[model samples]
Target: MCGTIDLYYALTNKEEAKGILPNLRFVKETNRRDLHDYIMWHNINHLTKFLSKKYEDAYTPVLKVNNRENDNDLIWKKCLKMIPDFLQIPLSSLYLRYNIDPRDKIRVEEMADIIRDTYVKSFRQNAWMDEITKNNSIYKVHDMKFKIGYPQYILDPTEVDKDYEGKMEELPSHICYNQPSMGKRNRAYLFGAIGSIISYFISHSFNHPNREFKRNGVWESWLSNKSLEESFKELQNCYRDQYSKYWINDQQVDGIETIDANIADNSGIFMALQALKNRRDMNNVRYTSNSNITEDQLFFLAYAQARCSNETVTPPPTSPYKYRVNGVVSNLKEFSDAFSCSRGDPMNPPKKCTYWDF
Candidate 1:
């Protein structure tokens, strides 16, 4: 009886959810009637269109209104994307073998260790937190588990199919944008890019890096000390004020609104730079730049390149991509040194804000 009632409520909520969904994939300005028709046609023809543009008329306007840079993908690319729904593991495995080097697992694990060490060092040097809090932070990093890559067993399709419904697949979250092509990037940039992404995803998972809350089991925090709380707030204000002043397309960034992403952005860059510095490969010239560019310069360039885009989401919780690059780079003196900008220049302002001052 309860299961039947639960099913009835589930169906009812799903029907009610239509009031909110509105078939708006990427934009709100699309015509409702047009979208409704598109959905009806799409339900019938989406698969057939991959073989041939059988319903281009129904989909073209949605792309145009969404301001998509390219309205059409290659036939194979579309098919490849669509096939994942039916053949996820096999297709992903094939893509991994073809594009992602198996050795990237080693790269990711090594980078994760480097970032963890960097975090510990930063905690040790942190002048704001009391030793108690600082020690707890260090302990957390020490105990944190870093899972780097997919399981080797996944390569066996027969084993996967036996319990597919119960298993959660580990996959690359942002293969194209986050992991920039290694050949196009200098070593410093490559390390920075990979290290940044490693820390970026990790940061989002176990958030509030600055706060501690374990009171027992060898790791605990009150998070109630007035002085430490003040220090934490000061750290937040530093990034918040810095971002609040940045204007994009006449809209001032809502620093308070985007504080988490802003903090993650700064922390990612900091951790990545630290990881690069922590490596034994640092010969003061990690990458030989052909165009008189320094290694550190290449690192920042790669970070910016991966993030370079003009698109901004409506009611952005993060700054625009341009500002994300600008805001992060401007906070670090190393960025100014990397590019050799004058101190008073826009990119190298005299004042900067930092947290965990590594």
Candidate 2:
């Protein structure tokens, strides 16, 4: 019963989102509100039924009693929910079930190389950092690892099964099958991961030639120079003040709460722009055939389009998509030069936050 319902939700949602599967064609015209309502109803009804059952019986086995794997339906449904591919369902399932065969290996490698070079260049050119720190940063950038697409081991059935087994063992029994607790756990894990990245960058930045960088779990030792410390604090305060004015839940949210994500968003976009600028192919590319827009304009447009979503459904914890686009671009002098935006223009704000040299 639970398998049937789970498959139904997965298939229906995928079809609605992608307009795939001729049998599910009617869902293509379904209103977004109606779709949301249907999902909410489905969750309330089916999830309750599934969760009330004994844990062992809640999810049916992917194989039948005859020791044969259930045909493509179950696997397809699982693929729709688990995989990140945006292609047609069949192709996506094939990719997920097989080896991680990236079709754009050359392109991915090229972008990675550009990003690495840009980062190294930025580190070396940063005026604020000492010579020793700059050298250390360049060494670290050279040592950085890149994991593109999925891991190759996922293609092996035995390895995939073992991975799932390990995950199941690691999960707390009480929260493993509990939807709300599982969501909370996922959020906690995400926060911890992001926190670790931010902490590493901060600690590495402040590391002294005589002292080793240690993760004492507190940010108190992030800066030692009195003037530099004050500048850092001022930079943070700028972010806090700017982001605090943005509305969340019909009220202004405290900027400090969103600082980490904002920093990541800003830094991530800047690095991407740098990579795009460094690409040799982009030298002759234009935004459009007849439009006056430049390649940089198109780059920013692409970034904005990727982030575009229904703002009404966005959570309070997340910044509005407009802010994500505007906030990042506003801090970039490259953006100002590309569009010839004057310093006091809204897109070229005078008091922009510059956390790192980027």
Candidate 3:
């Protein structure tokens, strides 16, 4: 059944892939290099957005506040204020290596798992979101799936082959060289980092059963108590609760769309904190803040501060990955306090911050 469904989906998706190939050929013939890059960029963007949206829906409220107030502005502003520590590039060399390491996929999957554990645990600890919301958020995350590295399996290789027809036959000789570096330090660093991330992930898996039980165990009982007909009605209502409003025109304001993955990470954490705060308030949990700011604003500012870094991209601002990760995280007060950011020079939010107090 799984194989048949996969095959059917593959065939259906291939038509769209093939349709784009002729345009790639056109770009090649026209000598328009930018067009080729644009196509590749959008193709990657679509995949990222699709995956992010799929997972994000279960965790976040779909309140799209910001046509005028986008997250990019906040991210960039925070990036500009970042220090050096949070912005350090421990894996720079490995990332730049671009060599086909056999363990690359395994390493990436491990990284995803590590990130999920850290962030999802934080989600559970948030003081703002309510019990039901926290439970739902955690449930969504505990059941969350990971698809690290590229979805090459989803790529129709035949369609890719069709695009390569009559293209350059001679591969770059420089890339084909079979030389292996003998530097032990560099080699150890690369392997060690990958191993460390994997170790963390493997250790976290042991705790998964408890997390799953907490979410599913109670919810399943409530859901199972109803008659079949009543259960179906509740299920239908739940679907409407989440997605029915998305179809209504003018439902939400405009927001910033960014190529930066870190922005989404920042926003996700911010919202989780907000939800935590709401939860805490409802539960009469005592909390104090010296910042004189709403948890919503502080959550966003924390996200912005996360992007703070001392590193600046030369004129054109290359390396969105580095900028998003190091720059943003460096600016947060929470991060700074944990890492000890100096007084009177904390991170700043965007000039036109669209405060999503939702």
TM-scores of the models, in the given order? Answer: 0.69, 0.53, 0.29
Question: Which residue segments of model 3 deviate by more than 4 Å?
Answer: 1-99, 150-327, 334-340, 346-358
For 113-202, candidate 1 gives per-residue lDDT tens digits of 888888888878988877877777777667777665565555567655643666655543323222434455455766666778777764
The order by descending lDDT is: 1, 2, 3
Order of models, best TM-score first: 1, 2, 3
Tens digit of lDDT per residue, candidate 3, span 281-355?
A: 556755456655544344444444434566533222123334343334443444445444566442332211111
Against the unseen true structure, what C-alpha lDDT does each candidate score? 0.68, 0.53, 0.38
* Lowest lDDT 10-residue stretch of candidate 3: 252-261
Model 2, span 1-358: residue lDDT tens = 3333443555457554343334354456776787678767666643432242353243346235547442234545855654433322333335555433344333445455666676677877777666655665566556655554445454455654564455423211111111122222222122222222323243233333212331233334333356755655666677778888777557665577666566656766666665555553456553344566555666666566656677732444446666777777788897798788998998898887765564
